[model samples]
Target: MKMNLSCCLYLAMAFFSGPATIFALAPENEVTLHPTTWLGENKITAVHLPKGRTRRLYFTLKKKADLMSVTVSPCAVPIEWSLAVRTLKDKPPKKSHWTSKKSMPEVWWKGSGREVKIYTYTGNAVDTYTGPAYAPASIYILRLKSNERDTQVSAYLHEGPGPSGVFPELPPDPRVHTLGVGMTSVTLSWAPSSSVVVEEGQRGNRPYYEYCVLVNPKHNHRSLCAVREGSKKDENEQMRPGKELKKDWWWHQPDTPEDNESSSALWDNFEDPGCVCKDTESVCTVSDLLPDTQYYFDVFVVDKVNGTSVPYTGTFARTHEEARPAVTPLREGQVKWVNLNGDASSQNGERSFRFKPRGWQQNGLLTMHTCNGTGKVKVTVSTKGQELTTQEVGHELAQIWLHGGPSYLIQLQASHSDKSRFCLRMQASSAYHRRAVPVFPAMLQIKSFNRLRTCNSVTIAWMGTEERSLYCVYRRQIPHGSGKHSSTDRCLDPESRPASERVLCKYFQELDPRRAVTTAVISELDPGVLYVFDVYLMRRWGLPIKYHSKTLRTKSEC
Candidate 1:
């Protein structure tokens, strides 16, 4: 009696679903040995075993046989079940317990599924069954048990020298390729397995084949991908049953101490993302990947019904790095307007600028204002390789204080993916104050000199001749007991002096030379040493006028 494709599918579906109705009526402790008609016959039988229950089956050989094999295939569900087999001479134990090894018959062989056990008769006196007439017919008893939940299983009995190939062969290795790579996602495509069509033609029904895409960190030995229950699509496309296929499809390398040393190379710190696609769909997109990272991609074809899978074919791809524009140079006291209207903007919507204030413009403010964009812009200010402040600004102005000397990094990143226009203005805070008239005096002098001394530093305050003028303070150590007082006639520019006699020069802008006392601190001075300090009023056109020299001494070591 041959069954058509529809009948076979209906029978398979009924076999998987029919057990639920009889589950309540079946006795939990019943042990019945359902028998096959003759030996060396290939026969499959299905049984419904409730949770924490056991089922016994047997096949008898009229003549001595060299081999006896039994295979048990459980339902395609995430449940635990085991199979045990033994050969009995007369009858099985009346009250055999599945868990007690002593109470049950001695097991001749044990396996999960698709495994065969062979026995050969040796011509020796100790060999009990050396020939067909040496012993009575043998009975093979197969005991199966299910755990956690009610399970339906199919048992195949064979009395032969080899297996009958009850399970289907693994499909061909998939040829995987990358479709698109991104910072946090990767799109992949592959050709459908040809075996699916071939097998459906031969078997008269569609075989149960599932495809899974596994992603592992490059060069990693341990696998972080696992299949769990309800992870696959169900018949209704809502809730499907799933189980862990064989581990042969996973990529594994030698795990030495050297390989496990780096935490970044392992999946412990990150998620190893993967996905499952049907035989009809050849493309899938895996998300939540790290940027600028290399990964190994493996595509597996699993026989979901038989719990069999073949080795995977894999390839490697690297995600693209985050997009950023080149650092733009920003000039002090100037307003720069950036129009991200066309191709000038970065593709990732980020921009950065480098700014360094002039030596005289120490106290300044940096302002960022978005003029055309609707959403806010994220502004980050950093100086000397350290972040100073960050703010989100829109049409409202965002401002931060800027100091001179050290270069500053200002980054402007958009909060949304829309074309934007923004302006950055950097100006000295004093720019808002009243300006003093440019005046040149015939002579300049340093008046009202006072000093405060520390163990390694000295602070000197004086009144200069003109405001808004640049001053250069020079310091020189006097030789011990030399009593040499430096004269203004011999004073030279710090850069023009000889290497050995070059003095330290510090430049200060006298913003309020008339009212505010100009102060300068000279630090890292030698203790118990006298030093001479001279203030020069620098003139761009002519020679700088030198003020009276003053001597000061740092305190002795504490």
Candidate 2:
């Protein structure tokens, strides 16, 4: 079915400003060095600096130098640090002659670990700098003194004057502010990543970046497969770990961070097609998730810079056993369940549950929670009772994929004679496919609002959203007879007034061409009278999405 998706584009609010330009890679000329003291133990070793040389850096550009400045980012330092930049002249400038003296700036990506400083230079002019000009052949010197021993640093010498030789760093790590955990979907929203200014002529540094999302099952949604019971045999009451699929268990990783114990093998890596963005945009919804399962979401932010941010653990969410459609507002905890085989005579007898889905895009899943009696439950579902799947139900939740279709029946029966009551539930979700939704579509927009044939006749087009089956075009003459673009400045509900007092035009959508879209027109009104037109897309589910209004006057019939 054709569904409107335009409404979803502007639903997110950015936490930070969008990115400016892309930072692909560091300049071709880059170097990373660790300073050493001559008195250090490794002084004579291959890595030691000369003795008595407290803190200094002497390096020559391997290639002819361009108008560039160097940025130094210290590594693994626990305290604050400061450094000075200088152009080493033939006479070797004294320590006090350094330019651009200041403490390094802190990087708050996740939390500040290291500090970085940028030393800029412009020909003849020491822009934001206090030192000499940058010549083609000039030796650079840096002096650093911090409580920390052996100042180790990574430096990037960005070639020639880029815009202010400064750009905003990677947007800070995104925080998941809103989360929708559905049986088969996880919708998330976060503030936009901050913007960065690139070199001259570069408008969008990094067009967009995507989140690398990975999930790990906190544990089985239901209790692990039942342990065979018996003390010694029956009394020993021995239970064993659930023999779930490798994908079901936590990944095993031999190497972990100092304090982290989670193994890498248990994690499920998902390529979130929705989470990818080319611009300063935030918000994504991931579908096709499992229900009743605990999942830890880990996300990494990748931006214009060639490097990727450290994985920031996201919220822990669990999918429900059932999903309620968003079309109509149903009472809380209200569920529609169809009886398959309501016969509850014996616990071992087959009990069937069935669900009819409204939309063709809906997929079905059956979940059963069996308590007390440890027993294996075999299930079959489809329009016909042909497919079969098995699960151990004693004291745990067992799920069966119904290979969704029109109407599916789920039949569950205990493998043995044990009496167990199976609490049943079903899940259904719509598979939405829309064309080219923008990374950020909130730039006050309407597909097109234009005056048709006459000022009194107008037509408007806008992006369609999921299940928005109807469009309402309403117009009421502006009070005080204001001209087009004048401030009508009032909220008048057209639906509240008499039919003659307002013109309400309803339009049904046609088959979409590329993206979901719809248009409606209003005509035959009095000529030259000022009017205000408001458009609302009536959704099949949930609330109607309203677009901005247009104020116009019909050309006078005179």
Candidate 3:
């Protein structure tokens, strides 16, 4: 009888074992957690698990508890459970610590009923627990957690065209209002940008701003300043906020409700605005710059929430200096070289020369005199390119600033027939420099045509200069004109030639070499005629040389 009774007890214990282990509960429960938010697309969030400190999480009750222990899954990699237990609220059970046999490899976690405990996770992570809890249910917060993300500053740059000296302001419409002249300083301003706001139970903070500016001298496609932020003067240090700040001064104030004052004045250093305020436009003023030089600049703006903005840019130019050295009618000159032949002297400190600028107005030519060691110097006439040409004459590396009021190439180096080279030097006259005008190149086109008695007519084209002494027109019955045309006709004055003898096509003197000027025309020819036209350069300084072009043809029809 005793043996049979013991067998019955053993069988009853085995049948009830599974159901008894199902309702065991733990102290903490796992709750539903939301997905983690990423600061940027390529960022990861994580935190260092403090030594000896284990994590606890709870999930809301779902269905019925049917298992012995619960489990929580790891986010990035595989993990094992360290300790799991299920408890019943209706029954007051004895306090006992239940531990697991598997050790935590870097990270470990275990879930019991509706709760989970994690340990040893490192770097960045996000863990989730899945299980059911006992009845008497109400929704609760889940402890879904992760480590902090690493942050850094991403640098960028912007570039644009600048002026020779100063720059202009940023126009309302960037594309339309541009600076043509160089300015002393540049200004940068931005539109208003919204700030991020904090919720009811959050901390208040102020948004900090930063900026950088760069100037590229060579325009070498590289930022001149490695880090070009604005600066604050020493005198502006008394602007920090005191103990208790207002709600608007806090960092998390939303755009609509609270009005936040900008720190542009502080960050921009109490100077001209250089990309500090998004609401107001700012200007960057630079000084102590060189003249007739070009410079490039770049600007960058920074905010608290989104960080730095795409760089904005503008440029300015500086005006020329007061006295700039220059010369007029650069190439063709009146008085070239006089070999200080010991006895050469200015008759009465007066020197003068005349060249007919036929079609050109006389006021266009300007003259200035310079002496090696001061024998005598004076200019007899005046015109356009420059004024007071004679008064500027001097013995010490003297220069003559000429305007030419037109395009003129001054002779820098002239070699005579004897191969002697003379270099002309130029200097600046305060008066002349002040009166200097912009000169352009003048174009002279000389076209000639030949007509024989009821035969053929051919036309030829060439360029002429205001320095031509005279032109010679030749006509022979072909088959003999050959290369001897230079000796055929007497040189005729290009200005006085009539339409009957030889047509005067173009005539120009005292004209702006910088502009375009054409010569007179020679026409009314017989058919089937052959003619040769030769033009010569009349020089006042060095050896005179002649330039020539020719054409042959039969008269045209009708």
Go through the candidates in order and give the clash count of each: 0, 36, 95
Residue-wise C-alpha lDDT for candidate 1, range 1-558, written one tens digit per residue: 355887897767767776664454456765535322221346556677687776666455546565555554454332333332234444443443332332232322331222223332211011111112113323344555666566555556555564344433333544578899999788887766655555556866444554557765633211122222112222124323564432212323224443234323323322213434344356777777778988777665544444333334567789999766789887655456554432234554667788765445444456555544366667788877888778886653445666533677888776665554434322222222223222433334443233467878887766554455667677778889998875533224444544544334444444454554567777788988988777766643223445667777778874
Tell me the spans in candidate 3 whose CA falls farther than 4 Å from its real position.
1-180, 183-213, 218-280, 303-310, 313-327, 330-333, 336-558
- For each candidate in turn, the TM-score is 0.37, 0.26, 0.24
Order the numbered candidates by lDDT, best leading: 1, 2, 3
Per-residue lDDT of 66-123 in model 3, one digit per residue for the tens? 2212212222222222333333333222232322112111011232224333233232
Model 2 lDDT at residue 340: 23
Number of the candidate with higher lDDT, 2 or 3? 2
Highest lDDT, which number?
Answer: 1
Candidate 2 lDDT tens digits, 133-196: 3532334444443354443333343443442223233336545543677787777665443432
Q: How far off is residue 210 in model 2, in Å?
A: 4.0
Q: Pick the candidate with the highest TM-score.
A: 1
Write down the lDDT that model 2 would get: 0.39
